[model samples]
Target: MEDQVELKRVFGDVYFRARRDQNTSIVYAHWYGSQAVETVKAGGYKFLEMIKEKPYRKLLNSNEHVIGSWDLALEWAQNEWAPQMRKAGLRYLAYVVPTTIYASMTMEMLIQRIDDEFEIRNKEADAEAWLLR
Candidate 1:
């Protein structure tokens, strides 16, 4: 994050924090733990609102520390968030999948179903590289 500029961290009901990297014009969200779909949506909507503060085109979302099944969020992610984000000028998304098996499966399914542009990576550095590239 050496070259990155920060937006004040935003928190939500779910275990996650979001900030903007002005250098890359990307919204970076780090999600943790298992959460109810409603809580997840709360955080997701917060993320969407953050991007609206600026015309960012890329997102680097890391699920590396996640352990809970968020399978329920898949539908909203694909149907609601993806479409809304695309309409908001988001052109690229670099999703860092969780290392834990169950969470990874859910996230993989989510990335698979999302209609908008996305590139999945195993690590944040890889995701950043992909986003920056």
Candidate 2:
């Protein structure tokens, strides 16, 4: 199937895009500023809504551009979002880790708690390769 850009949602400092290609759906996130709890929750809602509409086994989540720690958001994601997303047919999530130590740490923590296949890479290309594989 041809790649189609499905849901594109922006809330505060975060931008979410879901694009479908064949059996894969890439969920891209470009975030600015600190990821507040409300903004993170809104973004998570949009993400879940889009993924449920089109079940995708593969996902690429780019977070390299995020500048600050989203520790609280990470907790919410691990406890709330991850389980729901996994149930929505998300099998593998390839993530491009952020540059800051705190952001990276939070991402690591979230990754550890999730049951689905999760990979963290330093580059977007690497993340995409993992997702495609």
Candidate 3:
């Protein structure tokens, strides 16, 4: 019998369970839970491999911003995952969670980082219209 995978929601993100179809030699990430954050932080090389093992894609459907521990998340996403995905021809839309000035280095640094990595958009209307454009 073929194995079946399930999707779970955690902390507002949907994740998939990890599954392998031996006949097709394909691996799938079919589970998403709160543990995903930790899993990613703990060097989820297997997960990265799984994403590369097959044709996979992602669509960002939210406007949420990264809040607490934004730096850690940024470090992981940029230094670890983005390059691999780009090489694999995979695309992603991330709702970059916004952080307050106190939590981040500076407005210039944040903008430069986001511009260099991801497609960023403003979640709210305000004075910083230039940033979104």
Which one is best on lDDT? 1
Candidate 1: stretches off by over 4 Å: 1-14, 115-125
TM-score attained by model 3: 0.39
C-alpha local distance difference test of each model: 0.74, 0.65, 0.41
Q: Which number leads on TM-score?
A: 1
User: Which of candidates 2 and 3 reaches a greater TM-score?
Assistant: 2
Looking at model 3, residue 74 earns an lDDT score of 56
For model 2, residues 8-38, the per-residue Cα lDDT tens digits are 2364332444456654456554554456677
lDDT (Cα) of model 1: 0.74
Q: TM-score for every candidate vs. truth? A: 0.82, 0.75, 0.39
Candidate 3 ranges with C-alpha deviation above 4 Å: 1-39, 42-47, 61-67, 96-114, 117-133
Query: lDDT tens digits, residues 61-105, model 3?
Result: 121222333344556566666666556644432232334443334
| Per-candidate alpha-carbon RMSD to the true structure | 4.7, 4.0, 9.3
lDDT value, candidate 3, whole model: 0.41
